[model samples]
Target: MNAGEEPGVVAMDVESTHMPTNSEEFVDAPNFDLETYISRYEGFSKIQRLQYIARRCPRLKNDAYRLAIKDLKEGCNTASYKEIMATVGDSLGPGYGYDAAWCEAEDRKAAAARERLELELNQFKTNLIKESIRMGYHELGRHHAARGDLAAAFKCFVRTRDYCTTGRHSAE
Candidate 1:
């Protein structure tokens, strides 16, 4: 122990204190099939994993971004979509299948879907049918997941547990 230093405390060097903000430097892998690899994941994780790969792997950046954009188009994550588009434009060039009109339309559609699902859930609650309420929450959870609202989806899914009346429902 150094003079006046705590017995258990060890002074950290500058290099040890320096933490990398980004990912470990990626080495391009030969025969790496991005499609087959990405197919292993599902739901929101697929897009996020693809984005992570795109950011880290220089060789696979374009391909990863392309796949991520395609997946994003199917969901309501406009912010991530736009962010990816901007990154692609900055790194490579513009016109990698970005559509502003689609983003706007998707926002509207998602809002409408959320409203409809919430209304249906409210109706199911008023009916006081446990099964219907459970199903309603499940559907709402699915809608929120498709809309990129994971927290709401998780809450809705968790709410289904309260209405579960059978082992099968609990398993589901």
Candidate 2:
């Protein structure tokens, strides 16, 4: 009923004449001051306070909202909204924490880069040994072999092998 009208008369805002059936479905009146509106329900029941904030804020997954629910579940008031926001950076929406496939993809990318680097190193070593023998620097070639140059050590053992291939090296 209206505050000062007749007994059966009901109060209704200009835009919405049909009152909300469910308190959770209630939209805030136009130009409502949110903080003041929440404060008004503090002395009311917990369900009413929760409903008011839930309907008013409309950001259910926010860290501040989650902290408020936690506090409410623990039989305490929200205490401080800013403190709740400070404690949690991002709110986890209704799902598991990390993605296993994403981690695996990142690991595969790193492995591919490492493999490409190793292949390039092997190709460089093969080029160096061929050029050294071609220029007839045999001792310097042996020095390279001692330095763990893979191409010089494994592929350039020409004293043990048959005569060198013509185009590969003229080290006869």
lDDT of 1 by residue, 1-172 (tens): 7788988887878876877685577868668899999999876899999988887788888888888888888778887888888777655456566798999999898889889989988999999999999999999899888877789989999999999999999998
| lDDT score, candidate 2, position 44 | 19
Model 2 stretches with alpha carbons more than 4 Å out: 1-91, 94-96, 129-172
TM-score per prediction, in order, is 0.80, 0.21
* Model 1 bad stretches (over 4 Å): 1-23, 90-97
- 35-123 per-residue lDDT for model 2 (tens digits): 54444443214334544455455553243255344433333222233233344434545532233454455446545644564455456
Q: What CA RMSD would you report for each candidate?
A: 3.7, 29.7
